[model samples]
Target chain A: DAGITQSPRHKVTETGTPVTLRCHQTENHRYMYWYRQDPGHGLRLIHYSYGVKDTDKGEVSDGYSVSRSKTEDFLLTLESATSSQTSVYFCAISDLAGGPDTQYFGPGTRLTVL
Target chain B: AQTVTQSQPEMSVQEAETVTLSCTYDTSENNYYLFWYKQPPSRQMILVIRQEAYKQQNATENRFSVNFQKAAKSFSLKISDSQLGDTAMYFCAFMKHGNYGGSQGNLIFGKGTKLSVKP
Candidate 1:
């Protein structure tokens, strides 16, 4: 177990509404990542934080934003939800400080946008 | 730009049998890492095995092992003594080793292979 937890394991929202998912870690890991898993797409990186206040965009970052105000918390927000955004979101924390770090994932959040 | 490819979309194996899932990747970097992750019905990504590019020996974890061929840019996973609980969606992923301005620490994943272990 990586000591990671995600809030609101399942959520349903109407289109154009804003949704925010929280990722909290107890291990004080330096890196955190958010990904979405779809049927045909295994998992695509949405956003990742290397450290508090340092973030970067990922493969599928459109309509999504992330924040890392503290070492243990990373938040992912959907500016405006869309039906196409319905999918499973996952939060991961790297076990090490650098590259080739083995990422441990938390139980995903299932979101449905109507 | 690195991409991982898993040609087999679905695979089936009888209980107590062995199965190998093929994964081929394209990359220009010589130093990197290869990984295999399992996602079951629980929806959590579990790390099954990983292989370092510089390592000449294959990595093995109990019943899970990987055939890491750097020359061919192939990293295939072999599951021995497949069990019913081993059924899951297997994903092949790639990560660059150093921080050379590429997608380091970020994993590029293959679509996935749905494996079924039948009794």
Candidate 2:
């Protein structure tokens, strides 16, 4: 919580519009992740980055894109917002390069696409 | 496929009482890590405790501890001397060991057990 902050804590947008969520970390951790949480399902990963400019797809990355051009910032973008995309998104970071790292999560951003 | 399951959806405990949340995981890898994360109303996910699969010793953190049965593939959280502040959503997580001596950077989590401590 101290090291992580997420922008747009709550948002409501129309369907077919594009959306972007930003996660900023002051810890300068090597691993930054994006996860979406829903009612019945557990936290599902959308994307993650191991280093600046090095990113990979996660379990639920179908409509999401990410960019990590810097060590402190990671962005998750939705190409076309949909009602199904409405959920709580969390950004987590860890010092993975240091090993056995624990993840620090942001306050989370709630997005609603109607 | 590795999956973590939390059988309890919601639980209630009196103040200063104790409660245990159950978690079971399916994984063939012997080398892995189990974690208990707590999410308060503030929506911040906090690491409550962790247990390395290889270690037989259970993890203890003051009023919180875990009973980790590797052979049984069960990792449960036990809250001793529970307080009102302890009410939150508890999640059980599984992290598989990575090859090439690197971190895989992903965690499999259960649906979460919501605990409510009543005064």
Candidate 3:
């Protein structure tokens, strides 16, 4: 356990609605990442943050946005939810402390769109 | 772009038996890292083992070991004395070597291999 927790472990909402997921960590890791897991596609990176205010897009960054104002919290928001966005989202943290950048993951959140 | 491939979609092995999962990757860069992650029914991703490209010797963690064939572009995981706890979906991932501030730390993962440990 990396002292990571994801809020709203499960959510269901109608299409076109706004949805936001939160990831909180106690390790004070410098790198935090968000990923979506789908059948046949495995886990795809959605977005990541390196520091308090620095962020970058990942392989699958469309339809999603993220922000980090503090070291312990990273938020992922779906501006408008869609059926395609229904999947399990995971949050991971890495310290990169002069060793292998092994990331530890949170429990994950499952979302459904109708 | 780097790509990781797991040839077997599903596999089964009896308890106490040994089983190996196959993974192959494509990368132009000479130095990088390979990892195997296990996701049980609970859906929590656990890091099984990791191998650094710069290291010639294979990496092992308890009953889990990897066969790293750099020239062949293959990395396989071998589980000895498999237990029911090993039943889960296994994923292979790749990450390129780069500075901490760059995108090289992001992991690209394979589809996954469903391993069933039979009683």
Q: In terms of lDDT, which candidate is strongest?
A: 3
Candidate 3 per-residue C-alpha lDDT over B1-119 given as tens digits, one digit per residue, 9 for 90 to 100: 99999999999999999999999999999999999999999999999999999999999999999999999999999999999999999999998987653487789999999999999
Clashes of 1: 0
**Model 3, residue pairs in steric clash:** none
Q: What is the TM-score of each candidate against the true structure?
A: 0.97, 0.96, 0.98
DockQ of each model against the real complex?
A: 0.61, 0.51, 0.73
Give the 10-residue window scoring lowest on summed lDDT in candidate 1 chain B.
B97-106
lDDT of 3 by residue, A40-60 (tens): 999999999999999999999
Q: Which stretches of candidate 2 lie over 4 Å from their true place?
A: A97-99, B99-103
In model 1, what is the error at residue B91, expressed in angstroms? 0.4
**Candidate 2 on B1-119: residue-level lDDT in tens?**
78999999999999998999999999999888899999989888898998889899999999999999998999999998889999999999988876311235688889999999999
Q: Give the CA lDDT, 0 to 100, for residue B40 in model 1.
A: 90
lDDT string for model 2 (A5-50, tens) is 9999999999999999999989878888899999878788889888
Could you give candidate 1's per-residue lDDT for residues B1-119 as a string of tens digits? 89899999999999999999999999999999899999997888999998999999999999999999999999999999999999999999998987632248788999999999999
Model 1 deviation from native, Cα RMSD in Å: 1.6
Candidate-wise lDDT, in order: 0.92, 0.89, 0.94
Alpha-carbon error at B93 in model 1, in Å?
Answer: 0.3
Best-matching candidate per DockQ: 3
